[model samples]
Target: MAKKVKVTDACQGCTLCTMTCPSVFAMNADNLAEAIVAEIPEGEEAAVEEAAANCPAGAIEIE
Candidate 1:
């Protein structure tokens, strides 16, 4: 099953995740990157992990 990742306080709104994976990350109204996984199809875990790994602020958490 696909898991969900969330953006937290550590986020600096750098948008690195969004650039790395536009399929799963988006810039919210607050200008912070939010991980929207509800629409994510299966077999995309690695991409999510890449986003988490690329997040410089350590704000992305996979649940």
Candidate 2:
């Protein structure tokens, strides 16, 4: 099955997710990182997972 990603309220406005998975994440107007794609793109799951793993605020959520 495919994966989905989201940025939680705990985001610390850090760009790590954007830098780690630019294809799937981006910075919104609030400066917090957000999942840019509605769904995780093919072969990008690893990066998404890594972003979540590396997020200092532990704000990234994957389902």
**TM-score of each prediction:** 0.82, 0.94
**Cα lDDT, all candidates:** 0.82, 0.92
Local accuracy of candidate 1 as per-residue lDDT tens digits, 1-63: 667678888899998889888888899999998877664557667877888998889998888
Q: How many backbone clashes does every candidate have?
A: 0, 0
Best by lDDT: 2
Consecutive 10-residue window with the lowest summed lDDT within model 1: 36-45
* Per-model root-mean-square deviation over C-alphas: 1.7, 0.7
Between which residue pairs do clashes occur in model 1?
Answer: none
Off by over 4 Å in 1: 38-40
Q: Give the distance in Å from residue 51's predicted Cα in candidate 2 to where it truly belongs.
A: 0.3
Candidate 2 weakest ten by summed lDDT: 30-39
Candidate 1: RMSD over Cα atoms?
Answer: 1.7
Q: For model 1, what is the error of residue 40's alpha carbon versus the real structure, in angstroms, after optimal superposition? A: 4.9
